[model samples]
Target: MSDSSPLPPVRLHPEAELARDALSTPLLSRAARLARWAGPDTRVDAGGGLVDEQLPAAAELLGLTGDAAAAHAAEAWRVAVDTGLVEVTDEEAGTVAAGEDLPLLTGGSPHDILAVWLAALEAVLADATVPDLDDLAEAMDESGEIDFSRLDWDPESEAAFLDGVLGNLYLLTVTEDGPGDGPVPLPALAASMIVPGDLGEPTNDMLEQISDAMMRLDDQFRLLEPIGLVAYQPVDEALMGDPEEEPAAPLDETDVSRYGMVRLTPLGLYGLRARLLEAGFGAPAVGDLVDKGADALLDGSSGYGPLAARAETQQWLDRREPLAAARELLAAARGSDEGAPLRRLRCQQALSLVGAQAEPAVRDVLDDPELGGLARVWLSELGAADVPPPSADLVYWLTIDTLAAQLAAEGNSEELQTLLEGLAQQHSGFFAAAWRVGHPATADVLEAMGRLHPDKRIAKEARKAAFKARSQQGG
Candidate 1:
């Protein structure tokens, strides 16, 4: 995802609810338990990890039993120390205590709890980038420091690769056309990073690269899941028999899950958005424009998808009286700027959500040159009584405005092409009079119609009309 463009607005659960989820995540919950369980008896190494001798005891305390139990206990202890839930009191003696942030988990506001969770998320993300301890041990040099070159790892690139993967997952979760809550196949997610957009077929090398990345992500997501970042279904253990083998292709539709599937949890959405904002990305949320003015609402949501725009408009309308909101929207919709047409289009959409109470406001704008057509359409749709018919001039002006708005919003989409064809079929003399419409977008709309019309003769007429309109304006 480009940091330059704003991400699709996310619909986050309330902070209090998210905080509850954060408090329940396996890693954070284990860390919090260890924080409460810690005392003068709890010993740590120089790095603040639980001493090896105490790992079994810690694991038992957490009711964890198995070959990997000690490792899990050690991971939780590290998170406790990293997040300040368990602070080392004496470096030399290795004494520890419940840190300053521990009590805040039980007593403080939702924001405070989430703040600690974000810190823990950062720690987990950092850990996910490192090679396994066994690998590091094997790469240890004579002086005892692990040789990163031997490990074939670049710290910066590893972190960036993980960040990029999570960023893509976040994009997928929030985008309208993406699978919002559905699990994305792990191979597909990995391929998004490895494969270029324009690549038609994956080369043997690229497929191998994607396979390697998938294994890396499998490990990473396993670490991330305990912290509530993702709900991951690990690649089937049966598929991991030989690392040298080419990635297995799913035999059937049901077999795809064998490769793995993953989705961001709701808590993950909140965490990623916060991180994106801190990193200087414009990550908007659905209710962000609720308290802003109508102009801001229309302008801010002009680039939003249909669902997000409606959601934002509804939230903005929920706080104001219908009539006043309608009036404000109509007032904001009247502009000669290049963005005015879409803003008015968005305004019309917003007004549709208003009820009969806004009928007066709609009627008030019936004589407005810029907004009259919109007002008439709204009133006519609402089945309001005694609405006057629009003149030929007003109809032509409205047509230009509507087409301009569609052009701005969808950019010569198939739907616009269909609309253009229908309009030309309905009115034989459209291009002749469309060139004379007083709307600022008249020439541009005519030019778009010329480009979009399927019929060659009508297209030529549209081009001629556009030229005439531009010449008249230039004068």
Candidate 2:
């Protein structure tokens, strides 16, 4: 037997190297800068007060238009408040104007942050153990408004949500993460906020509308994580690929109550302590806490959500497991019997689970007559998306053979006729099958072929087929 193997899988982004190299292009560099800056809300501690005018200035520095910039900052604060990341007070806003340095929020790369939230929802679904997830609705409203009074954001559920987000964040950071240094600028931040697979990129006008909604949410909820008090750190290189590395930071020490009055009670300091311990940091000795400024800068940058939800859950096998799954499914199929319909159906289902990995194995099974029909159909569907279109000669040959087989099959002549008619209409050259020599014709297929002949061999084949029809009729 001849031996050959299917080609290796195609990666869609073959231009990755070129894409990376082009990051230095002026437009992208500007995008990267903006992504860093627009990532966090501006906050300052005015003694016990809050200062926010610099919010507009910071927005301007990020090159935002007056109305657009004001709105962007509002949205940043809104995502923070909604996700339980921060709290703000007008008192602290004054402090921000006075230039007092304050603690920043738990921060990391934007992609990591976004991944945590998305994966949190994904993890909730996966953990529920459902096969298909199309039925689930989002946590927010149909009007895109978050009614904080309505949500039951209990500590346990919030913690679970946080855990899901953090786990997912870890996965994105370690596996498919990208790079951006310095604070992301506003435009890039706004652009990235337009989630992938969303209808279209958000325009400045859309950003303004989003900002307005955030302002409304802020008025209703109050910004818990005050501006100037928290800033986002640049994504470190260490978080890029090492799944096992301990996070190079710790959670902030501010009490959840310090952020705002919310629908649910914030997890207390003790809970934060337990979380830190779970994150692999040893609790500080009693004396150590005193000197570290009665305050701890929360590791606003934890990697928990993405890691657990995405990396651990999907757990893509490096090379062998998919092939192994296919082999196991196939073995189970073969032990049943050659001609059994149940066995045939099992093999088909198994091959589908094996997906592209089972292509070769299923093709081999095509040699067995019992498996041929099922295998050919699988191969056609799976292979259609992969293989280039067939040439006219191959199409012509297959069309004739398939038509002949349908003619010989006893029970479905009308269905077969419909199939042939559809094929002739869809593919211009299949008219020969519709009018096949002695079958039916207005003039003749040979004359039609002669009139349309672009290639000498095709015309000859048409003429020969006509003669063969006459011979079969005992002409």
Number of the predicted model whose lDDT against the real structure is largest: 1
lDDT tens readout by residue for model 1, 443-470: 8998898898889999999999999999
Every model's TM-score: 0.96, 0.24
24 in model 2: Cα distance from truth in Å?
15
lDDT of each: 0.93, 0.36
Candidate 2, which ten residues in sequence have the lowest lDDT sum?
Answer: 293-302
Highest-scoring model, TM-score: 1
Shift of residue 448 alpha carbon in model 2, Å: 42
